[model samples]
Target: MTSTAINFNQVAYLLITGASRGIGQRMAIETSRKFKPGSIVVLLARSASGLESTRAEILECNPHINVVTSSVDLSNASKQLLEDIIDKSLSKTPVGSFELAAIIHNVGTIGNVERKAVDMSDRQEWEEYFATNLFTVGVLNSCFLQKFRECAKKLVVNVTSKACLVPFKSMGFYCAGKAAREMYFKVLADEENDLVVLNYSPGPVDTDMTVDIQGRSNAEEIRNYFKGLRETTTILTTHQTTEKFISILEAGRFSSGDHVDYYD
Candidate 1:
């Protein structure tokens, strides 16, 4: 169906990464209800079980929703896999009118090391964070932007962290990688395209990553810092952040480059 018809029904073809759990999984569930019954939701992540569980949850929420899962590691994703996904998506829906209504890039990683920049060892650990946070998002954006340009009515939402704006002391690598992804999209937004790309800071949510950080060596210091900033800040739940994101996406006035915050 054309976007004009689909828009009325909220039948969007949404593609979300990091959909196994956390913010990505929450987005999938929220979108299923926000969009139409026949809407196609494609989820990508590294865990097959998590993907399946997410799909099941979405199905439970909306039995008629179309949920597709791809268990591929975005960090080292092959070109063939990307091509295959695009081809499969096209095959499932009608051609020339299949718009990728929305895309959420939620895949990220945080290293365990708390050493200062000068004392940091094992450069490979930093490289891993960059691969997962920056490179993977860039690759996915390249593919999605191409497809979105071919169609119309596209929206790209990136799940960034507040750490990008206010740097966390020991988590320099994570902050830097997320910042790179933000910069890449900031430039992409300036380019000529029909797609509307938005970079979002979802705020600090309760997740496995945060729990890991709390258990780290510098946990007390980090907690103290956050506690001091708590009055000026707010931690969002997965549902709240995802809901706000979907509202912005549905508003359809999204510009090319805009940094949005869930807490604000």
Candidate 2:
């Protein structure tokens, strides 16, 4: 089938991490609305309650769409969650085909405090941040890329942060981790494969994480920065960001090495 022939209804599956809130939750709902009935969506989060709520919301939007929820702490790099998902895909049900159309890596973390370079004394904290943000993306990419390689259309959309491109003070660890994850896709896009990988920054949104960060010490300065960003940058609602992402995925506009900003 041609790329255009791959409609939402024909999509076999969509696996998304951190789907309980923020960009992940919005993306799940958007995918459900855009895709055809009976398309399965696997939602992963650390909160079982939140995952169930998200699944319920998606089902309400499209009852015919199959929603599966998994509560797992992605911060644990040793857990082969991605591998397990691929293994399950291989064991098809009697009713449908076994294929994953897309995988969205939206898992992430923010440090508890904004620390200066000299204040970052704990090496383990940095390691923990990398484990959650960078390592998990690598694991998922390896798993999904292998599983979907033979399929006609496969895509990986990583929801990264603007910090990957422009560094912000006190967010060194977070920036480092995000940069690493973005670079992974940068290299993977060059590999000859059926998969299309794209690293995307969703810009700033009115999310819980952003609110918490804004509540920190430099609140005034941060608020001013955001105000300036609103004037100079394109701040997207979760819905708008999700819509653009789906458009890009459906259009097959993504290449291996491109870094996409949600504002654009």
* lDDT scores in order: 0.73, 0.73
Model 1 regions more than 4 Å off:
1-9, 217-219, 225-234, 252-254
In model 1, what is the error at residue 132, expressed in angstroms? 1.4
State the lDDT of candidate 1 residue by residue for 72-122, as single tens digits: 987788666776786686565764454346778888887663666666677
RMSD (CA, Å), each prediction:
3.7, 3.2
User: Model 1 residue 213 lDDT?
Assistant: 69
Clashing pairs in 2: 8-36, 9-36, 189-256
Q: Please identify model 2 stretches exceeding 4 Å from their true place.
A: 1-6, 77-81, 85-91, 94-100, 217-220, 227-235
lDDT of 2 by residue, 137-232 (tens): 787777766666666667677788788888776677777778888888877766645556777787787677776676562336765666665677
Query: Global lDDT for candidate 2?
Result: 0.73
Worst 10 residues of 2 by lDDT: 1-10
